[model samples]
Target: MKILANDGLDQSGIDALTAQDFEVITQKVDQKDLPEFINTHQIKIILVRSATTVRKELIDVCPSIEIIGRGGVGMDNIDVEYAREKGIHVINTPSASSESVAELVFAHLFSGARFLQDSNRKMPLKGNTEFASLKKAYTAGIELRGKTIGIVGMGRIGQEVARIALGLGMRVVAADNNVGKASIKVKFYNNQYINVDIETEPLAEVLQESDFITLHVPAQKNGFMIGEDEFALMKTGVAIVNCSRGGVIDEKALLQALDSGKVRFAGLDVFINEPTPDNQILNHPKISLTPHTGAATLEAQDRIGLSLAEQIMNLLKNK
Candidate 1:
């Protein structure tokens, strides 16, 4: 069996596949080289991160490929249903990066409240006293305790976020359309969606009421989920954190909110475009920007890579 991996895999992952007498290929192949490589190797499986797009065009090119494995969560980059229609099994390691993503949300929460990036950038190069004075201004960070945190999704990742938030003495309000009352132990609000407490109101209520709002939902099928109107509905000076898919929140709408003082701060680990070459928010003083490193931790990489390897190996054995 042959597998083509777009991104490099860790040593353990490589060893696992090699142990199964499977050949794994890791190359810097762009879209042009994909079809040829698939045909030449008679590739049975392909593993990719966000960098590769498993669209209908690419799927059409590699009919011999029987399975696709995404190293992390979010199949937005891959054409999942389309792959299914073509009789290709699509598997993703959703749990592999859950902790990494949850940690990122906490990281952003701290960065927003403390203004770490701004303080780091403004510290004087030569004047120690000036730097000391500037650092004092950033000390006005808000405490997370006693604050109401609203989680928009209550799935695995969202539940993890809630657990952490509760541990920090922050009240958690979850709103999910799919989850029912018995599904969650947390207190549910009245007249809301079935399971999720806090009476699942529209998105606007979540934005307006919570002291902090974190989005954990997958990407929407349309233009954008959180747009200008949604931003407008948010409480003034509310901080927003997004570690999910980039298009989930409208970047333009967020910028406008930041400009008008509607939003106090934003911490973004993902953007609408992966590897944003000309990211406008990189230098935004109020926005904390990371290079999509939510799942870049050593532990996360090991788990995701090994998990993907295991799934791929299982598919090969079953075939």
Candidate 2:
């Protein structure tokens, strides 16, 4: 059983895999060189992260590969449908990273609502002025308690968000295109919303009604599901959070909305471009950005690694 672990792993994890008697080849392959490395190894299982894209080129190179294991939830890095067509299995450790990502959503919520990043930045510039300057600015913040939150996708991560939101005393409304009339157990809202209805009622209704809106849909190339038309519908001073896949929300549209005050603050854990340079979102005073680390916590990483390891081992043994 030969495996290629391209995603970085802790020493403990590597030792555990060694104990499993699998010959694991560890290498650092950037996106450009991933296909060649896979081709050279003739690996049966390849582990990867969002940094390495497992597109058709990589898939085509690995004739012996049986499974492509994504170390985290989002398989956005892999061409899942194409892999399926090629008789290759794609597995992701979705549940493994749920809590970590959900917590990151809240971290963004806190930073976006409270302007933590900017305040931290401005602190060093102030020499004589009291820290009270930043304290006064905090007055614009609103408590998460007693706020209405609308979640666009209510999958595992979204459901976890709803759990935390309810704990914080925020009301929750969810809409997913696939799930129709399904009921969730969170006590924040009495009514369940469907995607069709959510789109019809002028998105602004949800924006106006919700103090915070967090998106958790998968990425699509059609320029995200949210755009100028949807942004125009948001209430002034609305806060937006995106921790799902990149490209699910239009970056430029978000910038314009932030500038116009249609979106008061945006907490973005993912972006249209991975490792996005010091762009407007990073420089924007009202936006909080992370380097796509929503599911990068130690616990999440270990869970995902172990999950992927098990799945790969299963595939090799069963096949």
Candidate 3:
């Protein structure tokens, strides 16, 4: 069988697939030419990350494709239901990158709490000239311990974030309309563990009470999840982190909140317009930014690759 990892799969996954006699191709294929390329190459499986889109039109034209695998979570980039309805196997590794993304949430959270993002930008320019003034400005950082962190989703990633929060001794309040209750098992370096049970509450309660809020849910279908009204409900100086999806929170509302002191800081990995995100948001002094890289860690990519290889072999090796 032949596979085209349009967005590139980890070498570990590529090796695994090749060991099973599957030919794996890792190269950039233009979106406009994907259908022709698949047909000409007779590729049996197509693997994508966030960049490529395997929509109905591509699926309709590429009959040789037997399976569509996403290396990371979220099938929003691909037309999942439409492909599956046409008898094409659609698969993703939703749990593989959960820890990596959760860790990234904390990365942003930490940056925001300590004003590290702003500090880094200023230290290089004003460290010698305004040492005392800079020191005074960044002296009022908040500690993570004993603070409340509200998780907006209770899925795998959300649960991982909760585990980290519990391990750090922070209070966790989660809201997931779908999940009523979940358990987080925190393991220490010495192998001891603590099991914490999490009972979800309503979104409003979480918004009103949490000292820091992190969003881990899928993108809202109609509009942004956190908008003007939602921002108004949040505690003053509440920090927000969004690693789940772009446009999950309203950018305009967020900017207003930051300016009005309703929101203190924001840690953002994803944005409303990706690749070419808004210059204003990029230049915002209060926002800690990272290009959509929640699952870009080495461990996560390897896990995603190995898992993808296994699934691809099971589904298409014989076909």
Candidate 4:
């Protein structure tokens, strides 16, 4: 079987495929040339990340493709339902990168609370002259120990975040349409773990009660999930973090909230339009931003590759 890792696959995945005597192509293919390349190579499986788009048009043109694999959680880049309707298996390693994404959520949450992003950017330029002033400016940081962190979606990633929050001595409340409750296993540095049961609350209740809100929901089909009304329900000066899908939170509403002091700080790893996020939020003083790299850790990539390889082997091998 032939597989094209168009957006680039990790070495672990490539080795796994090679061990099974499968041909794995890691060449970069332009969107325009994808159909021709797939047809020419007789590729049966196509793997992608966020950079590549696997829409219905491409899937229709490439008749040989039997499976579509995504390296991360979101399948926004791929037309999953359309592909599945045509008998193509669409697979993603949702659990593989949970820890990595959870860590990034804290990275932003901790840094934003302490004003690290601003300090890092300004320190180099003004540290020599304004060191004492900068120190005093950031001293009003919030401590996460006793704060409440509301998770919007309590899936694998959300549960992982909850684990970290619990370990930090923070209160965790989550809201999910599908999940009523979840048992999170919090692990400590001493190699000990404890399971805690948490019951999910209503969206409005979570919003009104939490000191910090983190989003882990899927991309909304119609419009923004958290906009003016949702923002209004939230606690004043609440810090928000979104490392999930773009278009889940309205960027314009977020900016306005920031301006009005309704939202104290925002940590965003995903944006409405990736690669080119809104300039206003990018330049905002109260926002901490990262290029959608929640699942970019080395360990996450390796796990993603291994998981994809195993799934591919199960489906395509011995066929």
Candidate 5:
């Protein structure tokens, strides 16, 4: 059997599949040429990350494909139901990258809280010349120790964030469409751990009370989850981070909020128009940007690859 990892797979994953006599191909096949390549190679399985799209059109042409796998959590890029309806197996690695993504969330949160994002940029340009003036400008940094962190989605990633927040002595409040409450297990380096019960609150309530907000929701198929009205519900001078899907928070509304001083700062890992994000958001001084690297860690990539390999092997064995 042959698997086309269109967006590339980790070596561990490739090795695992190859050990089972499966040929794993990591060539960068253009979207327009995928059908031809799959047909030519007779690919039995297809694996993809965010860079590739597995819509109904491609699915219709790739009749030899037995399984369509997403390397990360969300299946928004794939036509999941349509593929399953065609008697094809659709799988995703939901738990694999949770810890890695959760850590990046804090990377943004900490940078925002301590003025590290702004200072890093400014200090290199004016550190020696305007040392005293630079120090005066960044003195209003906030602390995350006692601040409240609102998690917009209480899935695996959200729970990880909650665990980290609790460990840092910060209050964790979360809101999810499905989950009412969750038990977050905080692990210490000394092998001590504690279970903290967190009840999911209403979105408005979470928005109103939280000092910092981080999103972990699935892609919104219909429209923006956090729009103007949602922004209105948040506290004044709130710090927001979106490592989830792009357009989850209205970009226009976010800019307005940032300009008006309603939102103190924003950390954005995803964007509405990826690869070519809006210049207004990118150029904004108050926003910290990363090009959708939430699950780009080495550990996460390895975990995703191994998880996909395991699931594929198990499913193929059953077949």
Candidate 6:
């Protein structure tokens, strides 16, 4: 079987598939020509990250495709329901990138709390000229220990963040529609580990109680998960982080909260628009921003690729 990895697949995944006698093509095909290319190559499976869009039009034209594999979580780029309706298997490595994303959430949280984002920017520009002045500017910073972090989604990624927070001595509370409770185990450098049970609470309670809030929910079909009213429920000066899907948080509301001092700081890895995010959020001094790189780490890419390759092989090898 032939597979087309349009948005590029990791070399590990390609090697794995090739080892099993599956022809894996890692080429950039123009979106307009994808249908023809798939038809010409008779590709049975297609793998994508976030760049490519597999919609009903593409699926309708490429009838030979048996599977659509997303290297990471979030199938918003793919027409998952339509693909399934056409008898194509849709798969994603939801668990593989959880640790990477969870780590990024902290990367933002830590940097934001200590004012690293601002200092890193200003220090380079005027470090020698205004060393002590910059220090005074960043002296008032928050510490993570003993602070409460509210996780909006208690899925794999959210749970991993909770474990990390607990290890750092931060109190963790989570709210999830599906998950009622989770057991998190934190391991120390000395090989000692502690297991803690946490129950999901009401969104309002978590919002009102947390010192910092991080979002890890899936995309909403109707609208944003958190908007003006939700922000109003949060404690004043609460820091916010989002590594989940874009559009989950209302950017407008976030900006307003930041301006009104309802939100002290924010770390955003995902945006409503990719490659061309809103300039308001990008230019905000109080927001520590990354370009949707939650799953860009090398380790996560390898795991995602290997997992995707294995799943694809298992499903297609039988046919």
lDDT for model 5 comes to 0.93
Of the candidates numbered 1 and 5, which has the greater lDDT value?
Answer: 5
lDDT of each: 0.81, 0.77, 0.93, 0.94, 0.93, 0.93
What are the per-model C-alpha RMSD values against the true structure?
4.8, 4.5, 1.1, 1.2, 1.0, 1.2
Please give the RMSD of candidate 1 to the true structure. Answer: 4.8
lDDT of 6 by residue, 1-319 (tens): 8999988888898899899998988889989999999999999999999989999999999999999999998898899999999999999999999999999999999999999888888999999999999999999899999999999999899999999999899999999989999999898888999999999999999999999999998888999889999999988899999999889999999999999999999999989987799999998888999998999999999999899989987886686
Off by over 4 Å in 2: 10-16, 127-130, 181-205
Q: RMSD (Cα, Å) of candidate 2?
A: 4.5
Question: How would you encode candidate 2's per-residue C-alpha lDDT over 193-228 as one tens digit per residue?
Answer: 332222212345565577789988787866568888
Ranking by lDDT: 4, 3, 5, 6, 1, 2
| Per-residue lDDT of candidate 1, residues 120-173 (tens digit) | 677645247686677667777888899988788777778778767766778777
Error of 2 at 246 (Å): 1.9
Model 3: residues >4 Å from true position, as ranges? 317-319
Task: Report the lDDT tens digits of candidate 3 across residue range 1-319.
Answer: 8899999989899899899988999989999999999999999899999989999999999999889999888989898898989899999999999999999999999999999999999999999999999999999899999999999999999999999999899999999999999988999988899889999999999999999999998877999899999999999989999999998999999999999999999999998888889988999999999999999999999999999988877776466
Question: Which residue pairs of candidate 3 clash?
Answer: none
Q: Estimate the TM-score of every prediction.
A: 0.89, 0.88, 0.98, 0.97, 0.98, 0.97
Q: By summed lDDT, which 10 consecutive residues of candidate 3 come out lowest?
A: 310-319
lDDT of 6 at 259: 97
Angstrom error of the Cα, residue 67, model 1: value is 1.0
Deviation in angstroms for 230 in model 5?
Answer: 1.5
Worst 10 residues of 5 by lDDT: 109-118
